[model samples]
Target: MITKVTYLIATILSVKAFPQNIQLLSQLPSDPIEQPDSWAWGRHPKEGFGYKARNSLTLEQCIDNPETAGTVHCDGYDYSYPVELCISMPRLAPLKVCADAKFPKDFCVSNAANMVKAKGCQKFLTDMCIMDISLATSQPCADAEFPKDFCVANAVKLIKANGCQSYLTDLCTADVSLAVSSDCAGVKFPASACTSNANFAILDNCKGVEFPASFCTTSVQIALLDNCKDAKLPKEFCVNGDLRMIKAKGCSKFLGDICSQSLELANSADCLPAQKSVSVFRCTRSRDICLSQLCELKVRDKGSCPQ
Candidate 1:
């Protein structure tokens, strides 16, 4: 038998243990992202709360164009516009729950609405991105060629299994949009998808990255790189040869020219690796040639620097 003191300590320890069970419906964002017990991307309004107030809008308009659909009037701030459905949701990060035993069908479905409230549709997109990569590599994500609807149905199972949700809304929305617009099946994400947590940035340039909707805002470095051409590289990258080569020659001029443009690369980290990618792509030893060819393509195509 355990003593009261020992039992109490054990109970306390369990709360902070790795993969601790979470109540899917009621979990809140309080832990830091780096902590083992912290739910990844579980921070509330990870982008920041700037809206004055929420206004009612049709689901269609919101889905069709969230930015222009309606305005959110706040107390102190000017009337701000509504964001995407994914971003507008109060909480979108998935609750980290324990999967010790097989869950009943009702527990899965019944809690789905609540789970949606907690996790949003972000995870779905991430899974789709992973699936696209798997397919591109000739490694099917699953054993069978299930229909799109079948895949959609299995999405619930994915959530139940604690799978990713970064692109959930995009996946389902794409399916819905297929009948009306382009085929969603053809969408392909770059290798470094969802690397940043800038919500506005993701919506603008990093859509393929599939960050939580809350991460739609720009970062300080990204914002700074916009107006400052003389912006220096973080001290660490300056010392490294390959990385420095990318910055000094390959993307140096390109970075100065386009990194400031909102539509082009703003993240300096992204720029460095992108510039370095020319190193492996070209068959030439001449750094200038490699930089001109690869960097030009990246700038012209609006594509990610090679991974």
Candidate 2:
């Protein structure tokens, strides 16, 4: 009986031990073998499944046949997609219809100015349609509106063809002074070139160009001399020292002793020498008396006097 009971207990323990061994085996790490079409192969589409052949057709042909065209490349090979498809793809490049297409002569001629301005000189010069239009209209480049960069590159040609006035006017509008441009070297402008344009006159290149005496007023001289440091002004104009003295207090007293009626007389060749001689007198005595005494000394020493 004891052997029979012990065998029954031992058989029960063997059955429990078999279940625990199975549970421990289930808990251990495992690597499943991958199947050919299983999810382990990745979610990407297989080659040739979603592929589409690139349509080889001109933009004009594609535009004419939209449904048959499918996705047509507009901007060469850089951007190969339809215009409508560009909305979905924000990275798509801009269309270059004018660059790649041929338009009617009348259309390009009529819109030449606008097109050239929009495209700029660099692009306008390269575009066949725009270049043809430029040759037809002869604007912007021919007129005072020529681009500064373009003018700088072709300064000699433009100046020789249009003269310095027109070239300077264009350069002035662009805020490029001839003073800083080596291309303007040895170019002699006309005397009246900068009369109407004060901005042009103040350019360093204008210093050598003569001006009308009437234009060189005291106020204008102040501005002109400030810019044209080495300008060879007419002798009649007062020097910087004289101009300062004229502006100082009691300047009228000196003017009365000198030539009060006319500025030209005050700076004249004869008056300059007389003024220098009288300068040592300090204006304590009458200017007329001092002048007379000097005149007598000159007459006695030289045995003759100036008429």
Q: Pick the candidate with the highest lDDT.
A: 2
* TM match of model 2 to true structure: 0.34
lDDT, each prediction? 0.33, 0.39
Candidate 1 residue 212 C-alpha distance from true site, Å: 15
Predicted structure 1: lDDT: 0.33
Clash count (model 2, backbone only): 0
Those runs of model 2 whose alpha carbons end farther than 4 Å from true positions after fitting are 1-102, 109-169, 173-190, 197-199, 218-242, 245-307
Clashes of 1: 22
lDDT of 1 by residue, 1-307 (tens): 4696795566445445525542223434363223333223231333311111133343444445434322331121222232233233323212222112233333333334333223233233323323343331232233223334434554433321223244443343333332123333334434133332222232223333433212212233332322222444342333232332333332353343333232224344455444433333331333343334335544443333333
Q: Candidate 2, residues 130-236: lDDT per residue as tens digits?
A: 24423423544333234445554554445433323446545433334543466555444455655555655666656666554455443434334433333334433
Q: Assess candidate 1 and give its TM-score to the true structure.
A: 0.16
